[model samples]
Target: MLSLCLRRRRSPQSSFATCVLPPFRPLRCETLERRHLLASVSLTPIAADDQFSTDEDSVVLGNVLTSDRLDGSVAPGLTLRVAEWNGQPVGSSPIFLPSGAILTVEEDGDFHYDPRTSADLQGLAGGESAVDTFHYTATPQFSQIYVLGDSLSDQGQLFAATAGTFPPDPPYDQGRFSNGPVWVEQAAPGLGLATTLANNFAVAGAASGTENFNESLLGTDLPGVADELDAYLDAYGPTADPQALYVIWAGTNDFFLPFSDPAPVIANAITNIVSHVGNLQARGAQHVLVMNMPDLGSTPYGLSDPVLSGQLSAISQAFNANLAATLDSSGLAITPIDVYGRLEEITDDPDAFGLTNVTEASFDGTQVVLDPSTSLFWDSVHPTQRGHELIADLVLEHLSDQGTVSIDVSGVTTVPTLDARHESGQAGELELWLSADDASINDRNGPFEYTVDWGDGEVQSVQGTAAGVSLTHSYDALPVVTPEIRVRDQDGDSSVALREVVIWGTVGSDRIRIRPDAGGVHVLTLNGETVASLDPTNVDRVVAFGLEGDDFLSAAGSEIAVEFDGGDGRDVVLGSRADDRLIGGLGSRLLELRGDADLIGSVAASRLR
Candidate 1:
């Protein structure tokens, strides 16, 4: 078998080198030198009869020829017939080969071999050579992540640019505005990439367009997202790595800057951001993640003044709506992260997410909070480390949902492990701790997919890269339930963990009231104790059971349907205005009808009031 190899040039400016492989005979390792090195090489075996044809078996040579370097020159014994062979392949153009393979050469001389039908090679018979000429094209693998944003994503660029004067290291971790590593840094590991794999071009207070607001405030001009893109293009050339991930998160600072009319300000911000995405797509960026702005009005800075808070909130909503619509219409492979929704969720119910203070900043510019772990914001405008973790969680979950990143548990002897603990002080909420022993073997920090079966015919799906996640479910009827949790990696390999939990209910006689609101159904005792709150949008139905008591159940003026079971008692039940179900168990019961309701058990066993 003979092989044809293409190697990248040593010089960054140089293109590609084509090499000829010797026949299936052993050659001394020293005989092959750096000039014949190959990277990302693909080899297809030809017939021993000297005819180039496809075989059932082919050897893939990935990083096998790493020791040798290649100068931009073709070796002897091969006639390369590519279009404009002066050197570099022109922007991933396809070059058809006679051996049923489509060779695509990227601008950087990376080779991609796509095998077509083996029947195409049948034409070359009776010792005829495979091809008179050959063309080549290939795509490069995703190498690194490129980030362009404001202080939310800035690593050390602003600190270095400012000579470490602003955001002192004591309160701020290194150069970040936050108390610790930002979202991007926290997310890198989950992506199976090191922090260095992310090339961060973000700076502090960068607007969507060409201006840096923070730099201007400091009486100097620094790079914004636009300038950052230009600098990246200058360094890496116009043809970017098509497989790499590019993140663009801006527009927060745009809202912060003074503007007479928010309409034009929002329009300009979306326009600039869309323009940046277009530029990236034109330069061969295939995977791009754009994060929308969070609620600026809810920040401590905005909360200081009610009017300003309302204005900022409105502007943020308008900007996000427009940005989403614009990106959708543009028809690019762009994934928009809902930073606004995620932050709002954390703020609305802080306890559900292990957060205590969402409205106050941990750092007041002069003093730091006693425990910054539970606080959402470091300063008035920037998120603390805990907030950053949640943001990272949102990003990882989005990426996993889009199939950009996944957990890999294949080739592991030990399966993934999961542990569930009840979240303290929160009813119907459980904290799941998941980890795979195989995670570190290959540096695989996973975006693992978690499926939680609450064992009451209700299941929930959550995604995370870290070890801990929180999930909630309400059980109105059952006294106990066994919940099962499954953590699956990208390869579909999974591990299941189960825990039995006693639900919130009383065995004694109790007064139960079921009510439905716009959000969902609420189950409570007559004493105002919450039995369960079920969101119909998330769950299928709302159910409640009256246990051991001659319970008086009422579902008056309810807009949604509910189910109630009177257990071992002469119970009095009031039906809802909507479709409802009532069950009488083991005792005489009183059934009250309001709307079209279904009655269960023997009607003779129940008495009408």
Candidate 2:
């Protein structure tokens, strides 16, 4: 949410302009000179914004032109021009900007600019002051993310070693312990790296040292964090890739080792972790991120016993304190992430993070929650995909703060540009245009493949070699839905885009139902077929119309507000616990409210009982 504003020059010949830099703790301003036309402009020490910012990891460009002209001249033959953009040359007018940003020169010598698809701007006439905005999304600076830890950061080393008999895929996505992509995989694309950029070595149930508790307890041979690091050094040698981001997040299992006294166990765990960090630093690893332990006392495993919970809580705090102090004194380029503090915040106010359950695991031995996204923990230990996403956000924020990575307004080379539109004359069909720019487009980066998550449990993928491709999908359900589209190249680099579309019901009798959870609201047919699903983060309310015949409309366990309309014939309407609006358009109607829900509706030809 921090922005850099380059105000217009005061005079026609003035070479310098006052640049209002981001209020990064101690606010200050810098003078930037337009030494030459189309020169690249660079800003240093950009800070990350607070939680209230839209994109927590990005730096934005606000109102590049605050006055009628950037050159500050109104005389004939003089016009507004862009000197530079984030250290990249603003080549020429009418040129395509990075990440789908647009810049157009109007007929009346005016300039219209749009930073990205997410930003909206109006054309400003020559000599007329206007604000133009755009966002600077980060690009990957590290070669790869080298991981070493336990199940929290594991991406299937244990599963592969166990021959896929552990942590079953039905609930654990691919090899991850969570129900979906882990934090590292989710963070990859945002950093302009492919999911494969995460060369994971973390093993499930790994302790900080060479000994794993799972090996002793379950008779399995899983390598610990120290062993994982050793394996990396054996493969790549002692001179580790300095360009890579090395991450070490372990020690939870060490606390679980059968020990009557927790003091020595906690001490050993911290010592082992700190020692391993030192090993990586000694091996030429420059960029390292170490995540501290979360409050083990708050986990379902710890909560089972009140005495154990209190003991584990104290142990976690002690371990974190020791690890932090050790890393600080070591004077290495190691960044300590406070996973304990963030986890505490989420558990303290679950609703703020769109989580309804934090006290218990979503997946018990028998079943999972109605929506795992609404839960923090997937099991007694690992977090759900949504929980991992929050962790990724935290990691990215810290990286941005430390200047290890930044928003490169230059362009996104691996991420594809996406455009979506409704197919002409096709009410239920949508067309998507996908394209990407890879440095090695003529070599290994091409034949691009596209994956579409229809948001209704239906996923489809298509591959092509063209610069741009148009793919179409049809929907059968009514109401609004947001579909996520991802494009990946042969090199494993990828980008994601999302778009919303509204589907309509048929003339025949339709049974419409809305079920909302932490992820979003799901619209379903009477036969339990999903019509559409909306993400609550991107959408606010859902509106549906049951047009004609005897219709049934309901908002059953919805956490989001909904508006339903029974267009014609006899209708049966049900409201959820959330405040909902219902309209009985024609014929006789029956309206029912669930729980203590407030209802707004027209009573004409309607019976409310």
Reference-based lDDT, each prediction:
0.59, 0.59
Worst lDDT 10-window in candidate 2: 32-41
Model 2 residue runs over 4 Å out of place are 1-126, 195-198, 401-609
Over 4 Å off in model 1, which ranges? 1-142, 196-198, 401-609
Task: For residues 480-578, write the lDDT of model 1, one tens digit per residue.
Answer: 345666776543446645433233325566666756655555444443666555444443334455655676767777644555666667777777776
Candidate 2 achieves a global lDDT of 0.59
Compared with the true structure, the alpha-carbon lDDT of candidate 1 equals: 0.59
- RMSD, candidate 2, Å: 33.7
TM for every model, in the order presented, reads: 0.44, 0.48
In model 2, the clashing pairs are: 41-87
Clashing pairs in 1: 34-68, 34-69, 103-137, 104-137, 104-138, 105-137, 105-138, 112-138, 407-490, 509-549
- Give candidate 2's TM-score: 0.48
Worst 10 residues of 1 by lDDT: 401-410
For residues 370-398, write the lDDT of model 2, one tens digit per residue: 47889888876678899999898887665
